[model samples]
Every structure is written in C-alpha cells, then in structure tokens.
Target chain A: MSAIGDGRSMPTGAGLFDLPPELAIDTDVARRVIAEFVRGQLRQAGFERAIVGLSGGIDSALVAYLVAEAIGAERLLCLMLPYRTSASSSRTDAETVVERLGCAGELVEISPMVDAYFGRPDTGLVGAAGPEGLTASAVRRGNVMARIRMTVLYDRSVTWGGLVVGTSNKTEALIGYTTIFGDAASALNPIGDLYKSQVRQVAAAIGVPETIIRKAPSADLWPGQTDETEAGFSYPELDRLLFWLVDRRRSVEELEAKGFAPGLVQWALKAIAGSEFKRQVAPIAKLGPRTAGVDYLYPRRRPGSART
Target chain B: MQPLRIALAQTAPRLGLLDENLASHHALIGQARAGGAGLVVFPELGLTGYLLQDLAAEVAMRLDDPRLLELAAATASDGPAGLSAIVSFVEESADHRLFIAVALLEDGRVRHVQRKLFLPTYGLFDERRFFAAGDLLRATPSRLGVGVGLTVCEDFWHLGVPQLLALDGAQLLVNVSSSPGRDLAALNEIGLGTATSWRMLLRTYAQLTTSFVVFVNRVGVDESISFWGGSEVIGPNGEAVFSAPLYDEGLYFVDVDLGDVRRERIALPLLRDERLELAVRELNRIVSERAGQADDSTSEPGAEPGLDVAAR
Candidate 1:
C-alpha cells in the first residue's frame, strides 16, 4: 500500500513533485513502454517525424520530451503557438525545453488568425464578427484559440510531413477539459491514459525543466488563468476520486465511504458522463448492411493503410 | 539427458499483413535451428497479427495450405537436432469457419494442431465475436522426447486447461499469446498490472502442473492496444528459468532440463494424488443443479430461463 518512492528505488528528484501514493509509477518502466509505443505507432504509420503543440504547460512539454526520446530529437518539431494575452513566462519556459532537448522549435503567433475572426478592439479593426466579437466571452475566445492552434499545426504538418502527437492527459480527457476537434485531435496519443498528477510525476522523471514542472498549470488562454483555480479542485484529490470511480469501478457510495466528499464525487461523475461523446468516434446511423465502425470493423493500420 | 534449448520468438507482427509475417516466421525458424534450439515458439496469431477485425478472413489459411507446409519445412532440415516449432495463425475450416489455431511442426510436417479453446470476449478482446471456439484439447508426443501441450492466450486463463493438459500426459506446456498491456499502476512490482498478473499465473501453473511452462507473447501496437512481450520460461518447481525483456523484439534462448519435471513430479506428487473421479462427480452435480435437473436443484423458480423447461 506504499508508494514507489517509499521503499523502492526512488527516481532522481522525486521529492520535487507531489505524486499520489497510488499514482506513483516506476518512471523507468513507464519510459520504456512509452518509447516502444511511440516507435511502434510511427513505424506502423510509416512516418519518421512527429510534431507536437508545445505549450509551456507540463503536459505538452512532457510529450515533446517523450517524442524526442523515442525518435531522435532531430526528427521532432515543437510548435509554440501563443495568443496575445498569453503570459510571456509561458513562452520562456517553452524555449527552455527546446534548448535542453536541442529539437526544432518554432514560434507561431496565433493573435492575427484569432483577431481576424474575433476582431480587434485596440486597433479598431472590424473582422468577421465586427464590434460584437471583440467583447466575446473568455470561453468562446478560448475555444477559438485552441482551434486556431490546431489549424496551424495541421497546416504545418503537411509541409513537415510529421504526425501530430497529442498532449491531453487522462484527467483532462475524462473531465472533458479539451476542445473537441481542436486540441483533442491527433494521429496518436501516448499519455492520454496518465492522470494529471501522474503527468507531473512523469514530467519530473523525464527531465522537464523544474521551473515548468513546479509552475502552476494553465491553459494560458487568458492572463492569470490556471487549471486548478478554474476546476475548483486540486489534481491529486480529483485524480484519486477518478481512480476509484472510473479505473477501479467503485460506486459513488463506495467512493464516499473511502473518504471522498459526496458532492465532489457527484460532480466528477457528472463531468465524466457529460464528456463521454468526446472520448469516442461519432456513431454512424446503422442504415446500411455493413457500416464502418459498426459491422465492417477493421484495424486502423491494415495491410495497405500504412504510409508507403 | 540433454537440456532442451527453447527459442522464444517475441516478435511484433504487422497488423493484418500475412505474407510479410509469414516470411519473418520462415527466417526465424531457420535462425532458431541454426542456434541449436530443439523447440521454438511464436505468439498467438503471429502469422496474421491480432486486432484483425474483418481482416481475419483475408489472412486465414487452411490446414492444407501450401504456405503453412513450406513454413513447417523450415523446422526440420537435416539439422543435428530436429526442430519442433509451435507456430500460430488464423485457421479457415472447410466450412469457412475462422479459428485461432496453433500447429506443432516436426519432421518437416504439421504434427498436430491445437485450436484455441477460450475466446476472450470481454474488455478489450473481441475474439469470440469473430473466431469460433475450439472444441478439443489433447497433448501430443514431441521429438523432444516428452509429451507436449499447446494452448493460446485465454486458454491458459481457465484453470482447467492446464490441469487437463497435464493429466493428458504433457510435461511441457506452451502458451502463445497476443495479450494487450493495460492497467498501469504503482501497486504492482512491475508498472504494468497485466504483466504482474500473467507472471503470477505462469509460475503458479508451472508448479501446480509440475510441468515446464513456456509463454511466448507478441510485442507491437494494434490500434489503441500495445502488446507487452514479457515472455518467460517457468521451471517445474515454480522458479523462473528465464525471462525476456518487455516490449523488446528478439529471439531469446533458454536452457531447461527436461529431467526437472520428473524430479519435481516425484517429489511433490500433486498430480499423482489428483482425484479425477471426485472432481467429475462434483462437476456433474453442479451442472445438473444449475440446470435444475436434479431433485435437490437449488435454483429459484425464475432464476434461470431454462428452469421451466427443466420442469417440463
């Protein structure tokens, strides 16, 4: 019932991160499996290079490191796409990752694209939405920003000939914190299964800069925005609740008995249920005799499906 | 008595590519023979890969397929130690029923075929939905001078399979698998919960059956699931003879003494003391009771749909 750091070989700088006892994994084994998984995915698809949307946040930074480790850093391209309101410190943190990994990094400012649709109040420029769009809600603008970044990444992928690797973790995907078809789209996701707290644990182990790992996790959609403050729950507590409820198949009553607040458990359950559609493929109406993803099931990488 | 060298081909098969995988098997068999291995084992569906939803039919081969015969011919080619290789693939019956099968090759021919018995249908496995479940379980004599039993992944999950194989006079039990890796947590010795579970099962079955248990699992990604290839060889006394690294693609060799089975069986005598009649009688009573056939049937009136039929 003890964590890995207690009796087993503690990872280097393990004390720097706060990992839940149950979420603490052997970093070595995780790296090995992920390296193989990343390589296998790329090999099956017949792609030699991979592109990652590198936010200064820990999740994407960890993904960049993993891709660099799996395939050589020479083949990895980290795109830092930031909006005008994004914190300057976030860009600095991303630069540190690129410097340490010695991988290709590009700065793609998304303000022009975003402002073109939402309009710019400062320059008094009227875009597609005119004056009304300038005063859009932070949520609407955040979704636009995410989709714009996705657009840029896919557009660049055509030129780079690299697959887009996903950075969203299990915690975000389960709670539906991602913008569907925006940030959630990827050719393959390696760490979509790791919780946020577990993401931090792996980030620390995989040599993500300590400042980035220790910094407050945020979407950087706006100034002073943070995920924990927005979600209203610490990741460790939320992850533990999710572990019992989803992974262990514990009933809400059992989760309450295990000392999780009933209200928190109920809210978490709601989020997971509401976000269910984002996790799977959109179902096709079963009108035909044989439908793809229905009766005509086939593996993603069939014989001729690989990129020749 | 010479120690038998087993070559565990922990390969990563291309998803739904039959000819490419067939070529790999042919080369690996020759390599294993050149290395002086008497026995070589490949993972379940190594010839056609796992996660082949509708592609199963496209890659399936019949028992009389010339490609299978040619692959078998690679095992015994005038080598000092004639090779006995257990290769797995999708089998197409005369009636066109697709089945996951394992064939034992010796003397340049298909010696015996063991179709996979338990088709796991729950969780990530959609096997039973596509392939037919095998009906027979028997041990065959091998060129290794001992009785051999062959099984697929989920076949060993049932406790009765290994026991039945051992009772049928098998000294070496071989299980080929394409088991997907999931359930990662800090609770297990290894980071993988699946590997932890499989490792425990291999050791336990080895000791209980008093037989050498050899497990060969594939390594590769099929869609979302990645197969963990921690292939292992367990001795008769539940000790690990050798363990291949997880997720690494290579041909690994392990030397196991066939005499160890005799030594452990005589010392433990667990198999000898097994009461087959008692188990059969209890099984029959339970089956009849569950079916509401016996007078002492404990089933409720509507517990099972067949109870009314039993009453009629």
Candidate 2:
C-alpha cells in the first residue's frame, strides 16, 4: 500500500485565498469549489473512472449528475440493482436518467444473489423476519441485502477500475439511520454535507425527477416504511433541532428555548450524542509518539504544495 | 506544463428537496469559477439526499428536463476559459429505467454522461432495488487538452475501468462519490474497517495506472448513514496530493501536471509490464474460489416478511 498522507499537517489557507468572491455566497459556487478540488486530486492520483449505485433515489440522482459535470459522462458508469419488492417505477426512473445523460448502464437483480447466499434455513429466520421482533430480524435481513449489494458493487468495481460512490447524506448520518457496512460504503461522496432539506433544493435545481424530489423519504427496507415513521420525527423539524444542537453545540436547555418539543429535542440530543462514534475512524491506543488518533495534530503542507 | 486546478465541492443536501440542492450548486459553481478552477466536481447524489428508500422512483428525473439545461448553461457561463464541470443526477433513459449518472458540461453544453456500473444492494444501500447498472468504458475529450475518464463512485474500485481508460490514453480519472462515514464502535467491534481501506486500494491502482486520480466524497448524515467527506487526490505515484477533512463540507482543490503522470508511467513501466490475459485468468481463479466457499440457498419466491409478526 502507498503511504497515505495525513492531512493534519497540511497548510490550511492558500487555496481559500485564491477562491472566487461569488463562491462565498453561491451554493453552486461552493459545490464547484469542492468539485474543482476533487478534480485536481483525481489528476494527481492518476484515476480515470467513477462508479455509482443508481438507486433511483434523489440522493443517488443528485450525486450522479454532479459526477457527470465534474468529470465526463463517458467516464461515469451507472448500475441499477433491483430486488423483488423494489418498485418498477424506480427502475424506470433510473433508466430515464441514464438515457438522458447518454451514459452506459446495466441491471442486476440482487434477489437471486442474496437468496443464493443468505436465504437458506441455516442462515436463520432472521433473514425473513420483519421489523416487529426484538430480534430486529427484518433489520438484519435488510442489512444482509445491503451488504450483499456492496459486495457485488465492490467486486464489479474491481473489475471495472472505478471507485464506488456513496449516496448517504447528513440527516441520515446524524440519526444513525444507515446500515453499518451496507449503503454506508463508498470510495467518495459529494452530498453528505447537506441536510435533508438542502438535498431537495439541489435536486430540484439539477432537474431530478419530480416524484423523487417530492416523495417522503424512506429506506424502503420494509413495506410502507418512511424515515420519519421510524425516527418518529419529520426532517424539517429534525433539521432545525439538529442545526441548533449539533452544529451550534448548544446545550439541551438552549434547544428547549428554541421552542422545539422537549421530547423530540431530547430524542435528537440522545441520538446525536450517541452517534458520535460513527463520525470517526478507529480509536487508537497511545503507544507511539505520533499516534494518529492522539498526538499528531498540526498543519504540514499547503494545499498546492508538492508532496514531501 | 500548466497544473490542472480541480475543485471538489462538498455541500449540504436536503432529502427530496431538488430545488434547494440546485440553488446550492449554483452557489458552489460560482465559487469554483471565481477560484479560477478549470473543472469542478460534486458528490454522488449531491442533488438529492441518499436515503430515499422507496421514493427513489417517484423523484427520478429525465436528462432533457429544462432544469438540467439551465445548469448546463450555467456551467458554460461560469467557467474560466472554457470551464467544465461534473454534475451528478438521476437520468431517465429511453427505456425508462433510472440510472445514477454524472454529466459533463463544457462550454455550456452537455458533453458526455456516464452511468454508474455497480449497483450496491447491501448495508445502507439498496441500489439494486432501485437502479440499472451502466456498461461501456470511454473517455471524454475535454477542452482542457486532456482526455478524462469519468465514472461514478463504485466504478473506480474495479480494475477494468482504470485498465480500459489507461489503455485508451486517458490522462486523468475523476470519480464523484457519496461514501458514508463508518461507525467507530462498529469498526472497533468488527475490526473490518470502513471505506478508507477501499480508497487506499484505489489509490494504489491509480498509481499503477500512472494516471492522476481524484475522489470527491460528500459529507453529512442522511437517514441512518453518515456521508464521510474525506475527498482526496492521489498522484500517479500513489502519493496523496490533497485530502479534505472527514464529515465536513468544503471545496477541496489541487493542482497537478499531467506531464508528471506520463513521466511516472515511463519511469515505472507498470502499465507496459501488465499481463492482461494472465491477470484475467488469475481473477477468475480467485472469484471461483470465493464463490465456491459462499453458502448457496434459494429464497422462496414472494416470501414477504411476516408484517404481522414484524409489527409486534
């Protein structure tokens, strides 16, 4: 493996100074700034292709479009994987986008593959249960499906010479609504910074399908499932509370004064606080002088500086 | 050789809120243009939040939508000296299947669009439940005097994408991604790690291919998954040129000389020394071994999870 550069020591300010003035206010400009940065990185890294899972959802849709603009559509590869319960409309929507973009695409049914591996009796009833049991059997089954999909994606990625692009976002991250290694896997991501409300804005601007942009958010792991249904709170309310609490680092009391429901606020607080572990890499034991998780914290190089 | 200035736009996105996301893009694009960047890249599914579950189909959009054209126009106007950008979106093909794709805009026109080839189905992802995988490997010629190999996130991990691009003489490889952050507790417990290991592997391949590699990841939480914004750039020699912080939205930029890639390839001779046929055979052997070890069981058709028992 090549020596990975620890960014902790890199100089922090040169690139920001040369940035465009409009970028400060323009969300598109902000996105462009990030895109240009990634583009340069690609040039430096010597990679040539990108691969994304087209889930026919707004998140994946938005990511797909941004990638097309950053690189070229020719270098982009889209994959549509459908399961037995997955709506046909979703696949239709995915195809529509692929055709309009003029990119190449294929379809793979995960049902056959997943069933072949984990649907066996020995795999346990957990593979076929719904969300009602304390066993969380349905969740486990869904997770299996998700991991199986990732495995296929990774395998295909190895064959295709491209990196897997993740499609997760901020709201989900805060609430820990994602599977550990399932949809959470990817080589890179572009929209993880934005909240659920913000994601809708960008999607509309880029002309994502109206249905995708307007529908209530859900993971579709089980029938009639919506994100809010499981989380017990809507995104708008959740985002407001999250911004105040997590982004502002406000105390629970401060959040209550903001007029949020006490119960909801408490829930959000607990969820966010409990999920801190999801935000970091592996914890390190203090054995060496410069343990990555402990003592190595300093800016080393400028943004454009040559590698040491 | 003039260095290529590339920007990775890490921004926030609202679930099912396309209009808001587009406005955000407008702002980000302006920033990249003002920064004198030749190209800008955004995250996979940056236009929409990633946890759409069943709503993915309802919100899928077509490429010819007027809104997309407007974005294209913006790209043409905002770029510096023939500016270009890579934008991610859900495209509706003629056959009506939804595809996760990236569109390249140059001189205000849609240059080329590539669909993702790998549809992830496990964990927090169920792309197979929603999308169609893409086929074909081709580089798009950019006005910037370089041929670029474009692919969405999952495509970059496969060797075929890079091999084909390098074989076709692409100088740069750009991948737009939406990688989720890993849970530290899970990593500690499982010890299997998150996507970083995979990213390192990608960097190694890029070095082997002797082409510049740019990876742009998104940040923030969407549903149960957290998008870890650890976007980075790797040199042809597999050295880290730049990397963004984890879980924060920012525009990361790097300047690179394509000439260096050519020189590196000449010096190392890895691509030349590659035995493609033999490698394919070895790959087959490895795959067969894994498949043989896998447990095989057929799921009963239409075996819906017992919703009654589940609701309990």
Candidate 3:
C-alpha cells in the first residue's frame, strides 16, 4: 500500500508492504536493538538457546529470524505448531524459513492434543470435556489449540534448554486479539512492540520468504480464515490508528480530526481499554505491607536471580 | 599547549553488583592511565547499574567509604601523570537520603561532588521515587588546568545548569548519563530519537556556553531498558572532536584543546554579555506568581493563581 523512496517506508528499492509514516522505524536500528535485547534477555536469564513458535505468518517468521540473527541459527529452535485444520501451506512456509535460516525446525501437530479436549464430532471420542466439547464453538477450539501449543513449547523449553520467544505484535496485542497464557506466553517478546505492517517490513528486511510476507495473515484456526477479514480492517489502517491512539497519545477528537471515522475511532479506543488486563500482570489484593508488585519492587532478573 | 586527553569509559555496569562494577572501574582506570588520559569520565550510576528500585540502599556509598578511597587513590599524583577522574554512584547522606552523586577525584581524594539536580519521574523513568535531588551546583578547579563543571544525566537537561556552570567560569562541562533508548521513529537521523535529542543538546550547550561538552552515556540492559552508549566530545564552537559508536562498550580517548574555550568565548561573548541579575529577577517573579504569592503581570483579569488565562 506504500510507494518506495518516501521518507516513511523501508529504505529499500520497492516497498514490500504498507508502513505507517509514524510507525516507520530505521530497520537497521531496530535489528541492532532487537539483537541486543534478545541476547540480553538470554544472558540475564542464563539461557544459551531460544525457541520460537513459527506459524509461517509475518510476526512469528520475523521473530524467528530475529532470534536466529541474535544467537546463531544453531542456537535457535523453530517449532511449527499446527492444528489438524491448519493449512498445509503453513507447514511448507514454516519449513522454508527453517531451511533458509538453517536453524533446527520440528513439526508438532496439536491435532491429537486439541481433539482429546474438544473431541471429534465424526468419531465417538468422548473427550475430557464430556459431550459438551463436541459441540464446542470454533472460538473455544482455537483457544484450546493455542494453549496446547503453549504446553508443547514449555515442555520442550525444559528439554531444549531454551526460552520461548513471543510473536504477538502491538496491533493485535492492543486489540485483545491474543490468547492469554497461550500464544501470548513467552519468556520474552522481541516484536510485541512493533505493529503488524512494521513486522512485514522487518520480515522482508530479514530475508523472510516473500510468499510468507505477501500471504494474508491468519491464525490458521480454520480453513479460509484471514486475520484482516476476521478483524474487519486492514493491518495498515489498524496499525496507524494504534500508533496515533496509544503511542502518540492522541485524543478521540484529535484522531477523528485526522480523518479516521468516528465509529472506527470509538471502536479502537474501546478495544484498547478492554484489553488492558491482557497486557499487564494480575493485581494482588495488597493485604501484605510489601507485596510483590506493590511496595516491594525488583527487576525480573537481578544479581542472584539468574540461574547458575 | 598540549590538548587534554579525556577517556570516556562507556561501560556496561552489572545490575546491583557494586563489587563487580567497582572492579570494572578500576580496570578501566588502569587502561585509561596507560593510554595517558589526564581525565576519565564514567556514566551515571556506573558503580551501581541503573534501574535499581530497592537495591539503591544496598549499593549506596558515603564519601568517606574505604572503597571510594581506593578508587580515588588511583588518581594520587601531582605531576603530568596525575589522573583526574569523574565517577558517578549512589551517595547516601548521614540522614539516610540517597542521591545520585558524581565525584571529581584529584590528587588521591574527592575534590568535588555534584549530586543530580533533576530527577525525571515520568515515562520510563522512576528516579524521583527512589533518590533525592541535589540542591547545589558549582564548577571546581581540576588538575588539567581548567575549571571543570560536573553534572549527572538529568541535571544537564535543565538549560540553567549549563549556563550557570559556564557563568561560574567552567571551561569544560561533563554530563554522565544512563539514558535508556526509546522512540525509534525513522524521522530521527541518529536511528534512536533519544540519541538525536542528546546530540543536539550537547552541541547547543557547547556552542552557547563556549565550553567543551563531554557526554558519556552508559551501555547495557538493566531490566527492559537498554542504555545507548553514544559518548562524545564537543569543542567550544560545537564541533564534534570524537563520537564513540552507539551501544559499544569501550574506553575511548578524545583529545581537545582547552584553549578553544578562550578563543570562542572572546569571539562569541555570549556568556560575558549574559544579564544574570535580570534573569534572577524575572525567575523570582515567575516563581512567586506561580506560588500565588505575587500578581502575574502576564495573567488576564480574574485568572486563577498559576493560570495565565481567564474565562470571558
């Protein structure tokens, strides 16, 4: 959606995707900062390796690329978590990334894990949810699949001796579009601060496959499910709105004046406010004088906190 | 006259580890000494890393502390080999209030101590919640044959700090920082917006104050923040003599002729022409008006105290 050679877009020849002028970052600087962040997180936590859930989408693909860029590809493990309903192209695209980066890649199907909870409608598989899971909505099934992926990643985190890297972007995170303790769970997130369009720019810069970058972003929960269609908006427009509303701290009047629809602006504001809890730690009752997040404050990994 | 050799110790301090950071300072000082550095500057809280919420107490040191004495002992010489160093740390007063203090070490002793005046409390900063602000500022004589003024990170952010230092006959102004990098929008030429802003401020201070500006910002990750190390040396005319690479930890030596201060000051005469009494009178009036103790001449009729606008 953007033309090349403008002050905003990526400093490359032709634009790979749309990038909001305000969201346009120096990709070189972003890579350097992210590289340091990835290394810093691993070093602070006494980790030598990192794990990333690669969905073949731009977000996960870019995260995998960044993690691999920070620590060598040899130190990175790319897990392709696919449900039974997940598209075959997702696996192929994920495999392309692994092959390109030469990092360790594995395909772990979450179908059995998901089916055991949600049950199979065609077969008489009485899942743990009794008969209720058989009639479970797609939303419930998607959530279970996401959590199942998280379980596999964490279990492998022990065996692989690597921390899981998050793949959620700012646009989706602000909209409450992520599954808590599921795909949103990570030891550290490198790309959570970037918008979706910005993720594509980074993905393109980092040599993620063009096919993956151009393809419609989807959760791959079901067939023919694209994120834009489901969310009812394009990523460029959504990313721009979030940048102005959240990062720039623009008011409702200011945003409406900037040419966004009043209804759309109201909707985005509501979504940001509604998702506030998903973005923060659960609050304690503060019965104790020095609670963990209250009066007693400490950095996550202090001197003695790092693993020996 | 030979240019003064300054070593910028752009280091990555260990979070909450005083012994380790002190060891690093000692090692870097030895390196600076060997490199013939007349003065070496370390970033703010270089002895104890930035982002120490409760660990400020555990790492705070008094001026008479033996550990500080040992670090100052390295500067014990009166000859040309005598090294003057500026190092920052958490200073605990007898009253138990901790302040972010920078000390000028000369002739094996603490020559001067300047505590940070401004503590940024908003955005990603929480300095005011933990440490107390200093109430004084002065330029002290240094072994390098120049009056040197020292300031911590936020102190230089105030326009008054640099101006007052220059007015007090400071030929060199040094600001030590643990500034975290943010605002990565590409409109900034320096990649990081914080870096760009600091660059502009340092150059402007150097040119306006007609003094050499030395900025040493720390590098490393303490918590979620990464301090971008873009330490620099600006001449009296605002030209950069040296700029250390961003985010690289190294002890860099930058040589600058202190005589440029004399030449630029004589040519510009901005500091000499400064009307200090006029500024003082106006500032006092503004303060009183804001405090509701005096009428604000700029205020409209029926305006509330501290408010300049009145309802029609």
Q: Model 3: runs farther than 4 Å from truth?
A: A1-15, B304-312
Among all candidates shown, the one with the greatest DockQ: 3
- In terms of docking quality, how is candidate 1 classified? medium
Q: State the lDDT of candidate 1 residue by residue for A1-308, as single tens digits.
A: 23355476543335665677777676777877788888888888889999999889899999999999999999999999988898999999999999999999999999999999989978878889888998889889989999889989999888888999999999999999999988998988989989988888888878899899888889888788899899898888999899888888999888989999988998898999999999999999999899998999887877777798
In Å, residue B37's CA in model 2 sits off its true spot by 0.4
TM-score between model 1 and native: 0.96
Q: Is candidate 1 or candidate 2 better by TM-score?
A: 1
- Model 2 lDDT per residue over A1-308, tens place: 11225422221112212221111122343345345534443443345677788877778887777777778788778888877777776788788778877776878889876555445444454333332322446677688777877888888887776767788888888877777677877766677766676566556556676777766677767667778887798776777677677656778788888788899987876787887776556688888867753545311111232222
Model 1 regions more than 4 Å off: A1-7, A10-15, B297-312
In order, the B-chain TM-scores come to 0.95, 0.83, 0.96
Q: Candidate 3 on B146-257: residue-level lDDT in tens?
A: 9899999988889999999989979999999999999886656677999999999999999999999999999988867888999999999999999999988899999888
TM-score of 2: 0.47
- Identify the candidate with maximal TM-score: 3
The models' CA-based lDDT, in order, is 0.89, 0.70, 0.89
Model 3 DockQ vs. reference: 0.61
Sorted by DockQ (best first), the order is: 3, 1, 2
